[model samples]
Target: MLEEQLLQRSENKCELCQSGETLKLYAVPPQSANNVDNCIIVCDTCLSQIEKNKETEKNHWRCLTTSMWSELAAVQVVSWRMLNRLSTEGWAVDNLDMMYLDDETLAWAKAAAEDENDEIIEIHKDCNGSPLLAGDSIVLTKSLDVKGSTLNAKLGTVVKNIRLVENNTDQIEGKIEGQVIVILTKYVRKQG
Candidate 1:
């Protein structure tokens, strides 16, 4: 299995801090594939510290100095990100300056920084401010005209198995009258 392969690659130790206790697979974010190139084996302490907010402990991440030079792209990416976060620390800033990633890897690291800057995770919500999830049915609170078609979705119309639109919190896709259409979240209400 992939887990075993990862375990073998890391020699049954955490890739970051080399701790064998409580090891788990950590997938590098914004990755399309869940393969070894995009995943790293890490211990619980390293995982929790990496995922923590801006107030993370500076001493705990000194291990990055070694992990930053890892052969794996995923490890390098994570190291680059952590180093960037801790750049305010003099040692971290020096490491960031010394670290070298290929163009593609550098782009991936920069993308993570951009995502962190936009900290508000956008979520689809109904007119009543209730959260919407994929596969949840919703009722239209206001009638809407189907763009590029003659179908007029009536008020109180139920849309089943809704899919949230990526990058747009105010829209969702649902089937109405056997045709899939984009419905504004503001005109919908979560169904019981």
Candidate 2:
């Protein structure tokens, strides 16, 4: 439904240049949100150009000075996003102070831009260079001084039943001397 509305608003045209070749929705700068207000119909050419000249954010968004002054929410949001990305430039930084949005609308724009910072599942790599899976026993090849506690994990110590960190791809959770902590997978080797 949002896609359909976007198509209708842009009149099946690329909202940026009024071009009609294969209209697509562009979410300004932050790509996490893909929707009507946060997105505008664009074409493949514009998308690739944006990616190619990513280092030149100022020139890429020179079009926004005119586009930013528009009343459309999509336009405003796109302008806001682009300007924010280009905020490093002097002109874009000045525009941030000039740009104004009501509380409700500004809130919507921000909510749509919140990128997901989720946890990733991680496994121990190992001191011997082996991937440690869950339920596998491992031995610490090197001595480690546990921080913030008085647990001394000695070298050649065997730690059993290692738990892989759910949010990190290169770590495991294991208890040593009644203390639980994160251990780098590369420092642990799988034990039979």
Candidate 3:
């Protein structure tokens, strides 16, 4: 019944890492967020692993020679990212020479990859840990009335997982009581 039923179809584990910690629904051909063919189930670790591919300036597909044969686009995407990241590896560079992506699928993958919004902010943990990244839900420990705001946030309130403000390091933004606000990450406890 979740928007991302793909997780259930793929089973609750990350398709790549196989870790079950947190399964999330992500759009594969991110352009089609509403289409099932474009959605996939991935965990935070696998998602980050796949995301690492986008940070690279140049990509080589040799590392994915075996992966290119995968029928699943999500698998292909993950493999492509890994191959791109592995371009510096000696084996990958040599293999890149033989890697071939069909013009259509390659174009689809490339277009999907490039369309991601890198400027989007991410919230993280407040106790000197990472920022409150997206899709992480947490519970509040103390009641707080946002400064300069009229909202009455209650204590022990469950704040659905939060997203971080990309450029800011101290705030985790979330919605509570139908109002969206930025909260100190330290004030919330990560839910299991």
Best by lDDT: 1
Error of 2 at 142 (Å): 59
> What ranking emerges by lDDT with the best candidate at the front?
1, 2, 3
Runs in model 3 with CA error above 4 Å? 2-4, 52-69, 91-100, 116-192
Tell me how far the alpha carbon of residue 87 in candidate 1 is from the true structure, in angstroms, after superposition. 1.1
Candidate 2 TM-score, true structure as reference: 0.44
What lDDT tens digits, residue by residue, belong to model 1 across residues 74-95?
A: 9999898888776546687668
**Between prediction 1 and prediction 3, which has the larger lDDT?**
1
- lDDT per model, in order? 0.86, 0.67, 0.62
Candidate 3 per-residue lDDT over residues 1-192, each given as its tens digit? 554476766677765555688777766655634565656667775565566644442333342555555577666665554554564454554444455667766676666556663222222454534334477777777798987788878878888857877676667788998888888877787676
Instruction: Give all candidate RMSDs, comma-separated.
Output: 14.7, 14.4, 17.3
Which 10 consecutive positions of candidate 1 have the poorest summed lDDT?
116-125
Candidate 1 segments exceeding 4 Å error:
53-55, 118-192
Residue-wise C-alpha lDDT for candidate 2, range 35-132, written one tens digit per residue: 66567777665565544443443565777777777777767765665566555465765676578877865665565555422111222357654555
